[model samples]
Target: MLEVKLHDIGEGMTEGEIIHYLVKPGERVIADQPLVEVQTDKMVAELPSPGAGTIKEIIISTGTTVAVGTTLLYIEGEGSLEPVSEGKASETPKEEVPVLLKEKNEFVSSFNRVLATPYTRKIARDHHINIEDVTPSDPSGRVTEEDVYRFMKGEQLAENEAVSTIVEPEVLAKPISPDEIPFRGIRKQIAKKMTKSLFTIPHVTHFDEVNMTNLLKLREELKKEGVHVSVPAFFMKALVFALKDFPVFNAELDEENDRILLKKEYHLGIAVDTKEGLIVPVIHHADKKSIQQIHDEMKCLNEKARDGKLAAADIQNSTFTVSNVGPLGSTGATPIINYPETALIAFHKTKKVPIVTENDEIIIGHVMTLSMSFDHRVADGATAVAFTNRFASLIEQPNKLMLEMI
Candidate 1:
């Protein structure tokens, strides 16, 4: 018997919840075939079979979160499959086979799982109706409330005399209690990470306001030239230039070595607010990428983050991080630094406000608030202030970013 243990999938994942078993006990699977779907803190991933084998025993059930190296299941085989790098393309589950239009019973029998919302499933559960037994009226094979009701109605009819009373009592929705929710997924992992970052790092947050009057005009000009770019992309480019001047902010403290290790490369982590949690996908070399390239990559990463498709490589080795909460209507936030990284910057909502110019004339100007958090042990308040000042200057004069570009 070969043991299939849960390994680190990406971003030093310590544990993951067993989302579902693609293969069941006694089912034969080929090498490299996805045997199970596991939900890590960052993504939903499929674990491939180690070798061609019959699944002997499933030690861990669905929804159980287990640590790295914990045996999940046993395979009765020679175990010939070699492990690849974590989150390799081959590890992803195959694209679902396309199914043509089919009869209701045919569609139900062809798949092991039915597509249904939690509420729909709950309704079925309360009525003692098998979700599987309810034939979907929709072509997508989704079991809806009406479908469940239809199934209940069909079974309840005693020569059409039994109607309202039999259906009404069973259809009464059972409200799920708060205690019923098991705190054991990305939400749990986010809590763990936030706790670690807060307790370990002596956080010092500094606020800064940037005059975005020039940048707004520049963005419009670029858009007219058919060179579309987002404000965050511009901010990222400016951030890279700022990091070049204040390299100390783009560093990790090696506590064991008693030294701050300054990173030469700028792998910028853009914090994306996903449904799962806050997922920070890294742009491998932000300093090297053009504004357009950064924008394109950010779009791709953000989509992948929201869709839960980010790989281990996508979220690792970020020297510095930024959270653009402007679009989300955030005014400002004393954001926590990503652990071990020296600093993180957050861009908040911009408002057109009155500003006194160098000529002492009052004028309407666009201004955005920035909240920067840094590890107090590695850098001082003065250094953090200086860093943000440099960043603000770049944002205030966005044209300078074009000159600083590679």
Candidate 2:
């Protein structure tokens, strides 16, 4: 028997919740076959089998959270075996065998064994509803406190027809306590990173407005050729060009050595908003790829991010970052800097506004506002302003990007 230990799932992840087990004891499995689905803070990934063998036992049950390097199961096979440490298998009652055998039931129903946070379970208990019956809306398939409240509201509405209700003035005047949500998973990770960035780095923001008339026309032209381009793609290309001229923006401060490390390669980080939280996926070598190539790659990365399929490497090694709030229809925002990176650029919504041309004539044109935040320690106000101006020039006159495309 060989021990199948929970290996490192990368991205500095130390622990994961066993979402479900695909195979059972005595089941013959092949190499690379998915043995279990483990949900980390970033994503839900399938842990594959180590070798082709019959599963001897499952040491960890579903919904169990374990750290890395813990024994998950054991596989029996023909080999010169070495002594391996094993974990005790979870004990289940014989009468519960029928429930466990049911393939549709992914979770093993037991005390404090539901795939939910303590807050969610508390809300469920207060409402007198089972957490298992609450439909989970999160991508990880874990029940949330909101789900419990929603279930309670639905039940209350259904029973309202059978009962009469009266509102009291004292009850209405009483202040209600706000529900506190515990920070965990991706939300917790975001909070930690944001706090570190804000407290550690002295951020200076530079705001500018760009004439996006040319960019809009170019996007239309590209759409006609069966190539769909987005605002973030164009901004990413502009950032790469600006970084080439101002390499200081594409650098990180090494306080230990008291030096700045300037990166030669342009690995642009694109911030993607998902149902879980905000995740940034890096587009390696942004300088080498054309605008169309960037668009295609960004599309694939966004899909993976929303589906929680992004690997650790997909998010690593970013020299510069771009956060586009245009999709949310915001005019502008002062975005927080992604830690370790020297600078971050944000693109706002493109709108039709009246512009004064070179002849001082008022004409309607497409306009987009951009906000860039840089670490003051790495870059000064003048350098950050110059970089933003260069980026705006590229966006206003998109022919420069078109030349690169050709």
Which structure among the candidates has the greatest TM-score?
1
lDDT of 1 by residue, 302-335 (tens): 9877756677899988999999999889998899
> RMSD (Cα, Å) of candidate 1?
8.4
Q: TM-scores of all models?
A: 0.78, 0.69
**Global lDDT of each model?**
0.80, 0.78
What is the C-alpha lDDT profile of model 2 across 340-394, one tens digit per residue? Answer: 8999988888889999999999999999888899999888999988888888888
Q: At residue 265, what lDDT does model 2 achieve?
A: 94
Tally clashes: model 1. Answer: 0
lDDT of 1: 0.80
Model 1, TM vs. native: 0.78
How does residue 114 of candidate 2 score in lDDT?
A: 46
